[model samples]
Target: MSALLVAVLLVPALGAAVIALFPRGRDHAARVTGTIFAAVTLIPIAVLPFARDDGWTTYSATPTALRPWTEFDVSWVPALRLDFHLGVDGVSYPLVALTGLLTVLCCAYTIGKVPSGGQGRTLVALLLVLEAGILGTFLALDLILFFLFFEVVLLPMYAVIIGWGGDDRRRAARKFVLYTLFGSVLLLLGVITVAVNAGTGDLAQLTGGTGLSRSTQLAAFALFAVAFAVKAPLWPLHTWLPDAHTQAPTVGSVILAGVLLKMGTYGLIRIGVGVAPLGAEWAAPLLGILAVAAILAGSLICLRQTELKRLIAYSSVGHMGFVLLGIATLTATGLQAALLGNVAHGLITGLLFFLAGAIKDRAHTGELADLGGLRESAPRLAGLLGFAAIASLGLPGLAGFWGEAFAVVAAVERGGGLWLTLAVLAAIGGALTAAYFLRLLRKVTHGPTGSASVPAGIGGAEWFAWSPLAALTLAVGLAPTLVLAATSAPVRALTEALR
Candidate 1:
């Protein structure tokens, strides 16, 4: 099991090396080899859970909330007390799986279609590198190691955005890097505060806030929340996401919305709520307010957007708002909902970006007004687009429904003036989500064919890249326990810390 953990982290890096070091002109072969490497990663991920030598086990953890079914810990810097410690349990495994799945799909998509600004091989290499960073973050159990892994993703993603993105890619990439860098600074400070005060950098030791004082927990969680909020792009801090998503290439947008954003919500749950329970309780109301604000603001803004990709970007802000709202509730059900929301967003939004990118590529535009009557010329493409939009709008018995419905339920369960009000408003936000999506379907697929070209066919690569996500959306929706089954114990453990 430990060996499998090592494989998940290193395989993608090895894939990137294979692509980048390949002969300069062998672009097609490089892409093929890179994709095979990416595909190989899923094998370890799929097998690791089943191969757990023992049931979930805990180190000498406080409140006994930190458990890893498989773990690897070694001294990397004896002087700083930082170890090359990594682990996977119910809490992080689904996210790790999501990252692995999405990267392979994106790499596969790149094999057949390369956005103009960069060779497909280069983009594939970056994707592999990005996968390593995301995997490391999910797997890391040490604070400093987690931060290092977190920062590893920034540069490769910036390159992807600038090299392969749309017409204003430069400015969008700049904003993406700058905003996230600022967030990183605060994140570093938060991490250092926790480690120095706790006299250790291990997350497991600190999950119950044993060594930190109340005031320290308050200050540390503030820094941590804001840092992650920027990455989560929560509300006002979310300005970077739309521009980044709107200008990024299709695969770039897919990866960005799919798994990159999950890092923030995951951090908030694991580090913020885990390390500083009192602070989470202290700030739950304010966090809930901001989350609801993001929900309403994002949905209303989407209703006014004129571009397909940009509207989808803003919609992420709204979708993630529900995830944050769930975390703010700090209940087992709420946290579970957040986890479900994270994976669902990765699948549903990942597919939406793929479909949107296909539309843009065929028509050479994402402007809503220029993309009318898609169903007239391309019924299949339009049908896929419609399905994705419906899922995004949280149709019942779909992947999107459970997370959101449970989030509102959790909020109401919290039982306060503030929480009840939040519940009502969040339900309203759900209605608005439906409205904008229906409006999007009407404008893009229902009207008379616009002047822009609409391609009627989806190639094998697109289907190969898209089919799994579409199928999984319904699969997870129909059998949500596929996600929640592993999550029950870890979530209950974490929530117990809060109590």
Candidate 2:
């Protein structure tokens, strides 16, 4: 089990190295190597559930202390109180699995459609590095270790955007780096303050806001929240996202929506809330207010967006708004809703980006005015786009529905006039979500195909890349318990600590 966890982190780094060393122009070899490594990384995450002594079926009943799939801890830099520690509980398992799944699909997509002007080998190498960084962040248990893994993703993602993105790639890349670096700086300061004051950086030891003084916790939480909010891109700070998404390539956009965004939310739960409950309590109301604002603002922005990718990017602000709202409620159900929403958003938004990219590839533009009626020329493509749009709009019995509904329920259950008011506003945001998506559907798919040449349907590579997300979206929607169950235990533990 230990070896497997280590391999999960190392394999991708090794793959990246191999791809980097591969001869230039050997796109096929690079793609094959990346795919194999990405797929291999999934093995540990896949077997994690079964590897437990109590088995996968018993996960929901397992106690928090006993539920981690594996744990690896070792002394590293005794001076700084850092350890080479890593583990995965139910809360992180699904996200780690999602990362593996999306990385593999992205690699598969690259095999057939390398971005123009991108060196295939270099692109594959950067993706592999990015994958390793994401996986490491989810698995790391020490604050310093987590920070290292978290920052590791920065440069490679910048490369992906700058080297392979669209006309305004440089500007977008610079903006992305600047925003994230500002957050990273704050995050590092918070981590250092917590570690120095607590006398240790081990997350296991610091769970539930233990050890740190309330003042220190408050200070640390404030810093971490700013860092994560920027990443969660909670409004105002979110200006970087639409530009980044608009300029990035299809695969880049998929990973950005699917996995990268989760890093911020996950950190909020794991670090901000978990390690600083009193501070979380202090900030919850303000967080809830900002969340509602983001929900309304993102929806309003989407209604006005002419470009497909930018609209989806703005919608993320709204979707993540629900996640943040759930967290702000500081209740078990709310946190579980946040966790479930995290995974669902990853799957649904990733698929939306894929479809959008395919459209751009065919039509050479993402403008709604330029797209016209896709359904008339390509029923299959139109059907998939409509399906993703409806799912994203929180349609009943879909993956998106459970999270938003539960968030509103959580807010109401919190039982205050402020929460009730927020709940009503959030519900309105839901309706607005439906309006914008329906509007998008009407503009892009329902009308007659414009002058641009329309492809017959989505291609083989697209299907291969898209099928898992499509299946997961339906599977989770029909039986949300599958994911909710996995999250229940950890969320219960975290929320209990807050109380």
**TM-score for all predictions?**
0.98, 0.97
- At residue 75, give the lDDT of candidate 2: 88
lDDT of 1 by residue, 223-320 (tens): 99999999887988999999999899999999999999999999999999989999999999999999899999999999999999999999999999
Cα lDDT of model 2 by residue, 111-210, tens digit: 8889986787788788889999999898888899999999999999999999999999999999999999999999999999999898888887787887
Off-target runs (Cα >4 Å) in candidate 2 are 53-67
lDDT of 2 at 198: 89
Q: lDDT: which candidate is best? A: 1
Candidate 1: regions farther than 4 A off: 55-62
TM match of model 1 to true structure: 0.98
